[model samples]
Target: MRILLLGAEGLLGTTVWATAEADPRVTELVAAGRADVDVTSRDAVRRAVLDVRPDAVINTAALMPADLCDETPEAAYAINALGPRWVSQACAGIDAVPVYVSTDFVFDGAGSQPYPPDGYPRPVQTYGITKLAGEHETRLGSERYLVTRSACLFGPPPRSPRARRCFVDRVAEKASAGGDLKVVDNVITSPTYTRDLATTILDLLYHKAPSGTYHAVNQGVASWYELCRTALDRLGLPAQVTPIQEQNYTTAPRPLHTPLTGTLPDGVRRIRRPWQAALDDYLVQYPALRTDERDVA
Candidate 1:
């Protein structure tokens, strides 16, 4: 099966690309980052889809940096909301299943527990609003669509210096530079590993799961501070990270409890692994950070 992957260079998109490319079933995968296809441009997106004519289209594009979205609302809306709309429309035109990766920010973070897939999306920030709008447009545009919402992501890791800017990178940078790190303890959610999410997305596609919204976060949850601590501890780095409230760090307010959870369809299952273990796996990739067995003494 051939698959068209949008935003293939991004964190989630990169993971999806690696996973899909490795799959023997995937005969041909046409992967496009922002350079190859401008999702915000309807004509460009439509042209790319028509040219590929793949069996499936996976959208991992978004205007991230929630605070930046608030500062530039128009650009945010155009990319986050309208970009997915174009993908959905293009997918519908070619009669292909469109899998849209969404975020936990869609919730207002008012709930005490993990939010369900069926729950109404009530985003508080402009970033969340635009993402939720994208979800609506994707749902309306195509009958064959899978909307998967996840929380904080830690990978797919950097291919080059320019592309390295995920949560883990930020923490490591602060630690290495001896800069004071203030992570929000109040903001709680799952720190999803992109590889796990990518595998699950492929699984759902294989099973031909029903078209609707689903939560694909890891089985557990943590605050941003806790996640940072885990990342540092695993890397064997000693960095004093102060836990603070979300309000103290950012210009825009964030939802306090955007953690997500829901039952998965038969094909897909929640990735049951601790964030610390995932961090360990991540550290293995960076040889400079690996602890020597001889040094254990």
Candidate 2:
């Protein structure tokens, strides 16, 4: 399959690029970051898609920082909502499948259980609202598009030195500094490794899974505090971690519990490994994490 990946430099997109490139099934891969194409501009997106003429277009671009989205809603809507629309439209014109990367934040997190793929979205924050809008726009733009939602993504650091590190990286850094870490214990989510999510997506496409919304996450639930502790343990660090309520952290209203749980359509049974296993694999890939341990010692 020939694939065009948007946001190729992002946390998830980087893993997707690596995973797809390593796969024998992907015949051609065209990677485009913001430098290559501005997704917010419909003309730019359409031109890029037409030029590449890929068999599938995977859109991973988005304004993901929830706080930033809360501050600048228009930018969020443009990137997270209309960006997918433009990609889907372009793909539709060329008869290419559009794979949109969505988020678990689309749900309100009212229920204690994991959210089903078919659950109605009631987003409380601007980020979630915009992502939900993106999902709808993708569906509207193409009948054969796939929306895969995951959450709390952590993965190998981007190749760009200027790129910001993910939460797990920051946690490792803080642990190296031997500082106290305070994380939210109330906000539950499925902490997913980007590589695992990328592999699942490839499996879905390889199996020709029916086009629809799917929850692609590691097979467990955990709070931020728990995830942090697990990371520390895997890194062999003795950092002090304090679990606090979400109210003590930020003023933003976020979904308290939004772990996703559902099977992919068309009887495609994709087995998601546990989050712990994924984390272990990530640490092995990025042995730089052990630098923190050496520093502490």
Candidate 3:
């Protein structure tokens, strides 16, 4: 399949690019980052997609940071909401499938149970609101589309200069510097590995799975504090971990508990690896974290 990948330099996008390039199923791949095309510009998105004429357009592009989205609603809406609309429209022109990556933030976090793919969304902040808008736009713009909602993705550092460092990277940084870590114990989420997610997406497309919204995440849920402890223990990082509440972290309102689970169609394979296992795989890449040369995930 010929594929056009947007946000090719992001945390998840970087993995998607590498995964696609190496996969024999992907016959051709075209990567586009912010430098190549501004997704906020409808004409640019349309032109790029139409020009590429790919069988699939995987859109990983977005203004992802919740705090940043809160500070800039207009830019958030433009990139996160309208950008999907534009990409889907272009895909429609060539009968290509549109694959949009959404977030777990769309939920209100009031539910005690894990959220299914079709769970009702009640966005608590600007970021979630805009992402929800993007989801709606993606659905409206194409008849055959896949919207995969994921959370807490961590892997290699993002290549985009504008992207923020992921949670794991931040933890590694603070621990390596001998700084105490004040992590939230209440803000729970279904943390996933970026490479795992990228593989799931490609597998879904290659197998021609049903087109609909799906929750692509790891097998279990974790709070920031639990995740921090797991990383420190696994990587042998000696940083002091101080447990804290959600309110102590940032000014932006956060859903205290939003764990996503797969509701994939019957017969489709799920990304069932646990978060800790995925984290172990991620830690293998960090030489500084390894105590010995043979240490592996």
Candidate 4:
């Protein structure tokens, strides 16, 4: 499979690039960061797609910080919504499948149960609203496409110096320093490992699963506090982690519970492991991310 991966330097994009490069089935992989092609520019996207002539174009590029989105909705819409539209339009011209990485934030988080892949989205924030717009644009621009939604994505440290550290990394560093941590106990989500999500995405493409929308996340649900505690426990750290409600800690309105739960097409089995298992593998892969041995003692 010849694949064009945008946002190659991002947390999920890095793992997707690495996994695609390692896979025997992937014959050609063109990894493009923002420097290589700007998704916001329709002409640039079109040119890259025409140049690569890939069988699949996977776009991981997004402006995801909720505060940033709220502060600058136009910039957010341009990158998150218009960007995918450009990619989808380019792919449509070349008869390639466009795979868009979406978010669980698209839902309003009103329900207590995990959301289905095909559920109607009622986004409450600017970030989710723009992402939902992106999803719509992608569907409108292409006949064949995939929109995969996941939440609380964590992975190895990013290559870009400007990229913000993920939740696990920040918590691990703080715990290693023996600092008291206060985390939100509400705002439930599925903490997905990028490696697992990347693999599942590739598997979906390889199996030729009917492309619409799919939830690609680890199996379990966890609040921010529970997730931090799990990471601390895995590292054998005794840091004091205080759980607080989201209402007290956050200024932005967010979905209280948005865990993704769904299956792929019948022939293609879901390959995602439980969240705990995936998290363990992540720690093993990046041992330096753990708390210092001296700190643990």
lDDT of 2: 0.88
Model 1, position 53: C-alpha lDDT score? 97
TM-score of each: 0.93, 0.95, 0.95, 0.96
In model 2, what are the clashing residue pairs, if there are any?
A: none
Query: Cα deviation of 166 in candidate 4 (Å)?
Result: 1.7
Q: For model 4, which pairs clash?
A: none
lDDT of 2 by residue, 1-297 (tens): 889999888888888999999989899999998889889999999999999999889998888678789999999999999999999999999989899999988999999989999988999899999999999999999878889999999998865454566789899889888888999999999999988888878788777878899899998999999989999888888888988998788755889999999976453333377888888888889888876436674
1-112: candidate 1 lDDT, tens digit per residue: 7799988888788888988999887899999988899889999989999999987889887787788899999998988889888888889988898888889998898879
Off by over 4 Å in 1: 158-164, 288-297
Could you give candidate 4's per-residue lDDT for residues 1-297 as a string of tens digits?
999999888888888999899989899999999899989999999999999999899999988678788889999999999999999999999999999999999999999889998887999899999999999999999999999998998888666666667899889888888788999998899999988888888888888877699998998999999999999899887789999887787555788999999987654443467899889999989888766534454
Candidate RMSDs in Å, in order, are 2.7, 1.7, 2.6, 1.6
Task: Order the candidates by TM-score, highest first.
Answer: 4, 2, 3, 1
lDDT-wise, the better of 3 and 4 is 4
Q: Model 3, 1-297: lDDT tens per residue?
A: 999999989988888999899989999999999989888888999998888899899999999689889999999999999999998888888889999999999999998999998899999999999999999999999998889999998888778888877798788777766778999999999999888889888888887877899899988999989998898788777878999999878877999889987566444453687888888888986565554532332
